[model samples]
Target: MLDIAKLAGKIPGISHHFQQEMTASSQRLELAKTILQQAQNQQEALIERYQTWRDRLIFSAAMPVEPLDTRITIVPPPHRHSVFATDGSQIAPSHHEIAYCYLINVGRVMLHYGQNLHPLLDSLPEVYYRPEDLYVSRQWGIRTEEWLGYRRSVLEAQCLADMACGWVNPPGAHHEPNLAMVDGSLVYWFLDGLAHDARDLILVPIQEAWEQLKAARIPLMGYLSASRSVEGVNFLRLHNCTFDTPNCIMNCVDVEEQQIPCKVIEPLRDTTLWGENLQPGQRGPLWQSSARILELYDEAQRIYFCYVNVGTEIARIEVPGWVAEDQDLFNQGLGIMLAQVNKGFGYPVALAESHNQAVIRGGDRIRFFALLEQQMIRAGLQNVGTSYKEARKRGSIA
Candidate 1:
């Protein structure tokens, strides 16, 4: 147990330190805003400069797809439309458990607005105990937890895609404008540093799902709430670099070694930059991601994102290249998102419902292990037993 009195005694010093940090952050924010305004005015020139120096920059930044200062108000969604969303939770394989297995539960939701059809909400849970399922390559040092996480993400996307495809080609011959949403980034950033074969194992399935959505002409979105992404801020730093021919590694140092000149606005995130400027229901310009991992993705599957003010918080909305390139679909998708957030009272209702369906509480985990052990015993597996540490943890002695 924590000692509240001891923690209380340290509060003043912690507060003082936080206050100083906030002061510094405020200064940086001002500088960031100034640089943003300047970039907006010279949008064309900045775009050219970005195009010229993009290959030389070491950090990932946003590549503008629209005018830098563009801010579009959210149009009301169509009277009749559908939104499908999916979220996932997992029970990672634990060494202390009786069984070396993991389970992934994907919550699926379909909501129809201005239609009589009832919302569809359900979950699909799958357990993997086989050696092949439990390990990608034990010899390669790929941890089970990491592989499970990647598999979970892939399952979520695949489930969402399956639902959207079914909705698009229903048996009744009735169709409506629809959007598919996932709770987080679509980019497989976790594939970084993994071997090419491992990357393909994950990306292939996701890309197939993405292809299905695209082939059906269904728009898919990845919603990130309170995003701390610095892609946009990094772009600003690139623009603010004073060197005639900017080379990050060679020219970033100053004589006094105080700070990198271009980093005057250090620590400001894309959220802070947009939250300060974007009004409720307004979205900033679309920007393509410069992540290195995206090189592995098909050209049409590349990610593009924009920041939107959803009244409660700044949200980062990402879409595939196909969606971004299609103006009508992009507009429709954005409007649908805004409407969903408004209806949900500041967050996407579909995502929230799906999350509720996906979340697995601690008590549920305990019960799962207990059930597993019981089933093993019934199967005549007398060797089944939890590790000593796990047994002690269940009922600790005072």
Candidate 2:
């Protein structure tokens, strides 16, 4: 004992290091507990349940679980300082007799401040839904062909991504996008791509690009512009705030009235994300959704409603507007065989769905246009033609 004591006295640094270790251990334990609790608070059990089903069942609906959603309007950046905007579009999709062109417009805005770059909206692709060659589906049920339609949508969206990236840094450009804020999530944000082919999911390329961005420490973000899409029709799976009605009712934990603060972040560092409720997708851990809304104006006028079979999972289904013979809202009692068309580098969600699932059996363009005219009148707008025409440049107005 005497010899041990004498030896210990000689090693003063070891004693100090031991004391520091004990202190660190105590502090780390507390931190670990708090972190675990916070994670639990945000844990999504519904997502887990869905995952479990995916693993256990062989005959499940295998519905695409696109966790990312477009539930709100993107609040455009306040300034555009030398930013490069990017967009995408589908040239055309075959349908009935008329040609349907789908456009996805991308805009990227970058500002250089010293060595650091400030991105306004980097590769923010907004969908300008339209048609290429479409025919009425009332002759046949579109529901049966939903999977094929959805697959096409996924591919089209990916094409849009490619188009958007084409502008990120031109072949010989010296500069990179200061920030990249896409209109949709990293990729296939609205696509349940895994349902079709996991490797083919648009997420593959999107993920690769995103990783490159992260490694380069380039700030990249995505904005969910609208609350209703093919996948978003079913909004019950979300763990965060959701609006049953796309208008004035915001279903948030704290704020319950109107307006969901909005943010289109290029996550250089932690920041805010606000908009409508987002749907789910393949990018789980890396992608995050922050609570932010732009303003509380004009929410009462918007409404989104879609129907799906709650009992079973299924591949994505799209009831293209051109395929439906529903009464056109632009005119009354007239059948609307209308299809949205857009310029190259535009959005073609062409996967447009109606809220009420209006029957198109006896629908016509004249009556359908009439209803659309009424809707336009109620909204105090003269014509969507001008708006749509103006959108031809931006690729979208939604």
Candidate 3:
């Protein structure tokens, strides 16, 4: 076997790598500082340009400016509430494995805070081996990793939504705000590249999930930590000098002296701006996602997001436009999310717990294959041999 001691000796190299990244991050901070300074007093101008050139702007750009204070203290959690979080994991089909199949495992955690703090955990696994379930993209002639990813996304949403739909009041008539959270963007970020029909395969289920949650009177949110999206920066970019010119390239290239408008705010992600401004329990103003896929969704399901300072990191939290438009639901959702963050030490405990439950470990995979092999032997069927490379790895002495 390889010497783990030798691997431990590489700690210095890892530390060096960490230092290198921190140095680059410091450089980025200087650039971001310059951008924030240049954005001063220009919010209204940027908002105007956004209204005029929104459709013409890049799909990845931000919408109109929603003015918000740079910093605010964390809001205290509601005394009584229930928070539900779900996360899913998958074992992609492998040709070398005996079974031509895949599995998606979803984990859920429900946390209650009030008279007593407690948590309930559950995990569900679904296996797919049927030809139709194993492969997608019939029109395109082959199932790709992209299709599999999309399937997993749909399953994840469905699992959480189903759970939310079944939630009920606590014992003895105690009532509390109920909220559900998922671990990604509310928008299907990959749909921009898909045809309408193909996109619908994934979008329909997600829309149904939203409707189910809404009908159950539960607010659903998608939470993302370490977000680097440029929604805020792109909004400022709309205020570029080329926005109104007939022949302008929208890149400020035609200016006589190369006087690039919005130069200071160029290439910075919205997280940096929010990170500099928001305090724990505080969030940036909500803005609609500018992703091209939003056009495919109805207004009720269109995605909206805001950046929340979770004490440890600036996280982007997304919800449907309908949720954002509801003043009461929106505030309650925010409160529950922040409360979970506080309880989890800068992250949502329920999501973290669910992820832990859903992960498939190496030993588990080995046991799964062993079980499959045993079943084949009992049925008097020849076992599908593993690839030569895999066999060698299993039999090798060193």
Candidate with the greatest lDDT versus the true structure: 1
Candidate 3 lDDT over residue span 286-349, tens digit each = 7777777688888788888888888889899898877888877887888888888877888888
lDDT of candidates 1 onward, in order: 0.88, 0.29, 0.74
TM-scores of all predicted structures: 0.96, 0.27, 0.85
**Model 2 agreement with the true structure over 222-339: per-residue lDDT tens digits:** 3333323322211122222243322222233355333442111111011101111122211111221111110111121111122211111111112212211221221110101111
Runs in model 1 deviating more than 4 A are 253-257
Runs of candidate 2 exceeding 4 Å displacement: 1-177, 187-201, 211-216, 225-398
Task: Sort all candidates by TM-score, best to worst.
Answer: 1, 3, 2
Clashing residue pairs in candidate 3 are 70-277
* Best TM-score among the predictions, by candidate number: 1
Ordering by lDDT: 1, 3, 2
lDDT of 2 at 119: 30
Query: Candidate 1 at 185: error in angstroms?
Result: 1.1
Report RMSD (Å) for each prediction in the order shown. Answer: 1.7, 25.9, 4.0
lDDT of 1 by residue, 65-97 (tens): 888888899888889999999999999988988
Better of 2 and 3 by TM-score: 3
